[model samples]
Target: MIDIVTVDTPHPYPPRISAFTRPFWEALAEGRLLTTRSVATRALTFPPKPISPADWTTEVEWVELSGSGVLYSHTTIHAAPTAFVGDLPYRVAIIDLDEGIRLATRHIGEIAPVIGAPVDLVAVRHTDAVSFAARSRA
Candidate 1:
Protein backbone atom coordinates (compact mmCIF):
# COMPACT_ATOMS: atom_id res chain seq x y z
CA MET A 1 0.00 0.00 0.00
CA ILE A 2 1.21 3.48 -0.83
CA ASP A 3 1.44 5.94 2.02
CA ILE A 4 -1.19 8.65 1.85
CA VAL A 5 -0.07 12.26 2.26
CA THR A 6 -1.34 15.47 3.85
CA VAL A 7 -0.42 19.08 3.28
CA ASP A 8 -0.94 22.22 5.32
CA THR A 9 -1.05 25.25 3.09
CA PRO A 10 -3.08 28.37 2.47
CA HIS A 11 -5.93 28.05 0.02
CA PRO A 12 -5.03 30.08 -3.04
CA TYR A 13 -8.38 31.10 -4.41
CA PRO A 14 -11.64 32.23 -2.88
CA PRO A 15 -14.83 30.65 -4.14
CA ARG A 16 -17.59 32.72 -5.67
CA ILE A 17 -20.19 32.92 -2.94
CA SER A 18 -23.78 33.40 -3.96
CA ALA A 19 -26.59 33.78 -1.46
CA PHE A 20 -27.59 30.20 -2.09
CA THR A 21 -24.06 28.91 -1.50
CA ARG A 22 -23.10 31.13 1.41
CA PRO A 23 -24.45 28.74 4.01
CA PHE A 24 -22.20 26.01 2.69
CA TRP A 25 -19.06 28.11 2.97
CA GLU A 26 -20.13 29.39 6.37
CA ALA A 27 -20.57 25.85 7.61
CA LEU A 28 -17.16 24.87 6.24
CA ALA A 29 -15.51 27.70 8.12
CA GLU A 30 -16.96 26.27 11.30
CA GLY A 31 -15.72 22.76 10.49
CA ARG A 32 -19.12 21.39 9.60
CA LEU A 33 -20.34 19.87 6.33
CA LEU A 34 -23.83 20.54 5.05
CA THR A 35 -25.88 19.38 2.08
CA THR A 36 -29.41 19.91 0.84
CA ARG A 37 -32.25 17.44 0.65
CA SER A 38 -35.11 18.07 -1.71
CA VAL A 39 -38.25 19.12 0.10
CA ALA A 40 -40.34 17.37 -2.53
CA THR A 41 -38.40 14.26 -3.53
CA ARG A 42 -36.16 13.91 -0.47
CA ALA A 43 -32.97 13.54 -2.48
CA LEU A 44 -29.69 14.66 -0.94
CA THR A 45 -27.25 16.98 -2.68
CA PHE A 46 -23.91 18.49 -1.90
CA PRO A 47 -22.92 22.15 -2.37
CA PRO A 48 -26.25 23.22 -0.92
CA LYS A 49 -28.51 23.92 -3.86
CA PRO A 50 -31.38 26.35 -3.39
CA ILE A 51 -33.56 24.03 -5.39
CA SER A 52 -33.42 20.37 -6.14
CA PRO A 53 -31.68 19.50 -9.39
CA ALA A 54 -33.94 16.52 -9.81
CA ASP A 55 -37.19 18.46 -9.81
CA TRP A 56 -37.00 22.24 -10.16
CA THR A 57 -40.28 22.76 -8.31
CA THR A 58 -38.81 21.46 -5.08
CA GLU A 59 -37.10 23.71 -2.58
CA VAL A 60 -34.34 22.11 -0.52
CA GLU A 61 -33.57 21.95 3.18
CA TRP A 62 -30.06 22.02 4.62
CA VAL A 63 -28.79 18.83 6.25
CA GLU A 64 -25.53 17.93 7.95
CA LEU A 65 -23.39 15.12 6.51
CA SER A 66 -21.78 12.47 8.69
CA GLY A 67 -18.58 12.79 6.59
CA SER A 68 -18.47 9.09 5.90
CA GLY A 69 -18.01 7.57 2.46
CA VAL A 70 -16.19 5.09 0.24
CA LEU A 71 -13.45 5.89 -2.19
CA TYR A 72 -14.81 5.39 -5.66
CA SER A 73 -11.79 6.37 -7.73
CA HIS A 74 -8.56 8.36 -7.52
CA THR A 75 -5.46 9.56 -9.31
CA THR A 76 -2.02 10.68 -8.26
CA ILE A 77 -0.97 14.02 -9.70
CA HIS A 78 2.63 14.74 -10.58
CA ALA A 79 2.14 17.50 -13.14
CA ALA A 80 2.34 20.79 -11.37
CA PRO A 81 -0.17 23.53 -11.80
CA THR A 82 1.33 26.92 -10.89
CA ALA A 83 -0.83 27.25 -7.78
CA PHE A 84 -0.25 23.69 -6.57
CA VAL A 85 3.32 23.10 -7.67
CA GLY A 86 4.44 22.85 -4.09
CA ASP A 87 2.18 19.89 -3.58
CA LEU A 88 3.35 17.46 -6.16
CA PRO A 89 2.29 13.82 -6.26
CA TYR A 90 -0.95 14.55 -4.50
CA ARG A 91 -3.85 12.14 -4.59
CA VAL A 92 -7.33 13.33 -5.51
CA ALA A 93 -10.25 11.00 -5.05
CA ILE A 94 -13.93 10.64 -5.80
CA ILE A 95 -15.90 9.56 -2.78
CA ASP A 96 -19.35 8.07 -2.58
CA LEU A 97 -20.91 9.40 0.58
CA ASP A 98 -23.11 7.32 2.80
CA GLU A 99 -25.79 9.94 2.19
CA GLY A 100 -25.69 8.95 -1.51
CA ILE A 101 -23.96 12.07 -2.78
CA ARG A 102 -20.66 11.86 -4.57
CA LEU A 103 -17.91 14.48 -4.23
CA ALA A 104 -14.33 14.86 -5.39
CA THR A 105 -11.78 15.51 -2.66
CA ARG A 106 -8.17 15.10 -1.66
CA HIS A 107 -7.37 11.79 -0.08
CA ILE A 108 -5.60 11.98 3.28
CA GLY A 109 -4.98 8.94 5.45
CA GLU A 110 -2.34 6.54 6.59
CA ILE A 111 -3.77 3.76 4.45
CA ALA A 112 -3.39 3.72 0.70
CA PRO A 113 -6.39 4.59 -1.41
CA VAL A 114 -8.05 1.60 -3.00
CA ILE A 115 -11.38 1.38 -4.76
CA GLY A 116 -14.16 0.72 -2.26
CA ALA A 117 -12.08 1.61 0.77
CA PRO A 118 -14.21 3.19 3.47
CA VAL A 119 -13.29 6.77 4.26
CA ASP A 120 -14.18 9.67 6.49
CA LEU A 121 -14.31 13.32 5.58
CA VAL A 122 -11.68 15.50 7.18
CA ALA A 123 -11.42 19.27 7.28
CA VAL A 124 -8.22 20.73 5.92
CA ARG A 125 -7.81 24.15 7.49
CA HIS A 126 -6.07 26.68 5.32
CA THR A 127 -4.89 30.14 6.32
CA ASP A 128 -8.37 31.59 6.05
CA ALA A 129 -10.45 28.77 4.66
CA VAL A 130 -11.27 25.10 4.96
CA SER A 131 -11.48 22.32 2.39
CA PHE A 132 -12.16 18.62 2.62
CA ALA A 133 -9.95 15.57 2.53
CA ALA A 134 -10.81 11.90 2.90
CA ARG A 135 -9.25 9.49 5.39
CA SER A 136 -9.37 5.74 5.06
CA ARG A 137 -11.56 4.14 7.74
CA ALA A 138 -9.17 1.22 7.81
Candidate 2:
Protein backbone atom coordinates (compact mmCIF):
# COMPACT_ATOMS: atom_id res chain seq x y z
CA MET A 1 0.00 0.00 0.00
CA ILE A 2 1.22 3.49 -0.80
CA ASP A 3 1.18 6.08 1.96
CA ILE A 4 -0.46 9.35 1.01
CA VAL A 5 1.34 12.28 2.51
CA THR A 6 0.88 16.01 2.63
CA VAL A 7 3.46 18.02 0.82
CA ASP A 8 5.41 20.63 2.75
CA THR A 9 4.38 23.35 0.36
CA PRO A 10 1.87 23.27 -2.40
CA HIS A 11 3.35 23.80 -5.81
CA PRO A 12 1.47 24.81 -8.90
CA TYR A 13 2.26 21.80 -10.99
CA PRO A 14 0.66 20.93 -14.26
CA PRO A 15 0.58 17.61 -15.99
CA ARG A 16 3.37 17.13 -18.45
CA ILE A 17 2.04 16.55 -21.90
CA SER A 18 3.67 14.12 -24.32
CA ALA A 19 2.79 13.07 -27.81
CA PHE A 20 0.79 10.07 -26.57
CA THR A 21 -1.02 12.02 -23.85
CA ARG A 22 -1.94 15.12 -25.78
CA PRO A 23 -5.19 13.72 -27.01
CA PHE A 24 -6.29 12.73 -23.55
CA TRP A 25 -5.70 16.20 -22.18
CA GLU A 26 -7.44 17.77 -25.12
CA ALA A 27 -10.41 15.57 -24.55
CA LEU A 28 -10.52 16.50 -20.90
CA ALA A 29 -10.50 20.17 -21.84
CA GLU A 30 -13.52 19.43 -23.95
CA GLY A 31 -15.31 17.77 -21.02
CA ARG A 32 -14.69 14.28 -22.30
CA LEU A 33 -12.75 11.31 -21.01
CA LEU A 34 -10.51 9.68 -23.53
CA THR A 35 -8.58 6.44 -23.45
CA THR A 36 -6.69 4.27 -25.85
CA ARG A 37 -8.26 1.10 -27.15
CA SER A 38 -6.30 -1.76 -28.60
CA VAL A 39 -7.17 -2.49 -32.20
CA ALA A 40 -6.53 -6.19 -31.82
CA THR A 41 -8.01 -7.09 -28.45
CA ARG A 42 -10.23 -4.07 -27.79
CA ALA A 43 -8.53 -3.48 -24.48
CA LEU A 44 -8.75 0.01 -23.09
CA THR A 45 -5.89 1.81 -21.37
CA PHE A 46 -5.93 4.99 -19.33
CA PRO A 47 -2.86 7.26 -19.39
CA PRO A 48 -3.04 6.65 -23.10
CA LYS A 49 -0.23 4.74 -24.74
CA PRO A 50 1.10 4.56 -28.25
CA ILE A 51 1.04 0.79 -28.49
CA SER A 52 -1.48 -1.78 -27.41
CA PRO A 53 -0.66 -3.74 -24.25
CA ALA A 54 -2.12 -6.99 -25.48
CA ASP A 55 -0.34 -7.53 -28.80
CA TRP A 56 1.99 -4.55 -29.00
CA THR A 57 -0.18 -3.33 -31.83
CA THR A 58 0.50 0.22 -32.94
CA GLU A 59 -3.02 0.61 -34.26
CA VAL A 60 -5.04 1.93 -31.41
CA GLU A 61 -7.95 4.32 -31.31
CA TRP A 62 -9.28 7.01 -29.00
CA VAL A 63 -12.41 6.06 -27.09
CA GLU A 64 -14.73 8.10 -24.89
CA LEU A 65 -16.32 6.81 -21.71
CA SER A 66 -19.62 7.65 -20.05
CA GLY A 67 -17.88 8.71 -16.86
CA SER A 68 -20.31 6.93 -14.56
CA GLY A 69 -18.80 4.79 -11.84
CA VAL A 70 -18.98 3.40 -8.34
CA LEU A 71 -16.97 4.29 -5.27
CA TYR A 72 -14.53 1.46 -4.74
CA SER A 73 -12.31 2.84 -2.02
CA HIS A 74 -11.42 6.15 -0.41
CA THR A 75 -9.48 8.16 2.15
CA THR A 76 -10.14 11.48 3.83
CA ILE A 77 -7.22 13.86 3.66
CA HIS A 78 -6.87 16.32 6.52
CA ALA A 79 -3.61 17.60 5.16
CA ALA A 80 -3.11 18.24 1.48
CA PRO A 81 -0.76 19.87 -0.98
CA THR A 82 -0.80 23.58 -1.72
CA ALA A 83 -3.12 23.34 -4.65
CA PHE A 84 -5.57 21.32 -2.61
CA VAL A 85 -5.05 22.89 0.80
CA GLY A 86 -8.15 25.02 0.54
CA ASP A 87 -10.13 21.83 0.18
CA LEU A 88 -8.92 20.08 3.25
CA PRO A 89 -10.74 17.14 4.67
CA TYR A 90 -11.34 16.14 1.10
CA ARG A 91 -11.87 12.56 0.05
CA VAL A 92 -9.63 10.87 -2.46
CA ALA A 93 -11.22 7.79 -3.86
CA ILE A 94 -10.73 4.96 -6.26
CA ILE A 95 -13.64 4.87 -8.60
CA ASP A 96 -14.61 1.83 -10.61
CA LEU A 97 -16.08 3.15 -13.85
CA ASP A 98 -19.02 1.46 -15.38
CA GLU A 99 -16.83 0.63 -18.35
CA GLY A 100 -14.68 -1.57 -16.08
CA ILE A 101 -11.70 0.71 -15.52
CA ARG A 102 -10.71 2.04 -12.11
CA LEU A 103 -9.22 5.49 -11.52
CA ALA A 104 -8.05 7.34 -8.45
CA THR A 105 -9.98 10.58 -8.25
CA ARG A 106 -11.27 13.10 -5.73
CA HIS A 107 -14.74 13.38 -4.34
CA ILE A 108 -15.67 17.08 -4.60
CA GLY A 109 -19.12 16.95 -3.11
CA GLU A 110 -20.50 17.74 0.33
CA ILE A 111 -21.50 14.28 1.43
CA ALA A 112 -19.14 11.44 2.17
CA PRO A 113 -19.38 8.64 -0.32
CA VAL A 114 -20.18 5.08 0.58
CA ILE A 115 -18.42 2.06 -0.81
CA GLY A 116 -20.31 0.69 -3.77
CA ALA A 117 -22.29 3.91 -4.13
CA PRO A 118 -22.98 5.38 -7.53
CA VAL A 119 -20.77 8.18 -8.75
CA ASP A 120 -20.50 10.38 -11.80
CA LEU A 121 -17.83 12.41 -13.45
CA VAL A 122 -17.36 16.06 -12.50
CA ALA A 123 -14.93 18.12 -14.48
CA VAL A 124 -12.34 19.97 -12.45
CA ARG A 125 -10.47 22.94 -13.81
CA HIS A 126 -7.08 23.98 -12.53
CA THR A 127 -5.09 27.07 -13.43
CA ASP A 128 -4.14 25.77 -16.84
CA ALA A 129 -5.53 22.27 -17.01
CA VAL A 130 -8.66 20.27 -16.43
CA SER A 131 -9.06 16.99 -14.64
CA PHE A 132 -12.00 15.13 -13.08
CA ALA A 133 -13.79 14.42 -9.84
CA ALA A 134 -16.02 11.57 -8.77
CA ARG A 135 -19.15 12.69 -6.98
CA SER A 136 -22.22 10.95 -5.67
CA ARG A 137 -24.73 10.51 -8.44
CA ALA A 138 -28.05 12.20 -7.93
Please state the error at residue 127 of candidate 2 in Å. 3.3
- Estimate the overall C-alpha local distance difference test score of candidate 2: 0.77
Model 1 worst lDDT run, 10 consecutive residues? 1-10
- Model 2 CA deviation exceeding 4 Å by range: 1-12, 81-83
lDDT of 1 by residue, 52-120 (tens): 888874578988888888999999999967877777778999999888889998787678998998888
Candidate 1: regions farther than 4 A off: 1-8
Q: What C-alpha root-mean-square deviation, in Å, does candidate 1 show against the real structure?
A: 4.3
lDDT of 2 by residue, 1-138 (tens): 111223344334567888879888777767788889898799987657899887899999999888888999999999888867776777889999888888898786767789999988766666556666787865
lDDT of 2 at 3: 14
Leading candidate by lDDT:
1
Candidate RMSDs in order: 4.3, 6.7
**How accurate locally, in lDDT, is each candidate?**
0.78, 0.77
Error of 2 at 131 (Å): 1.2
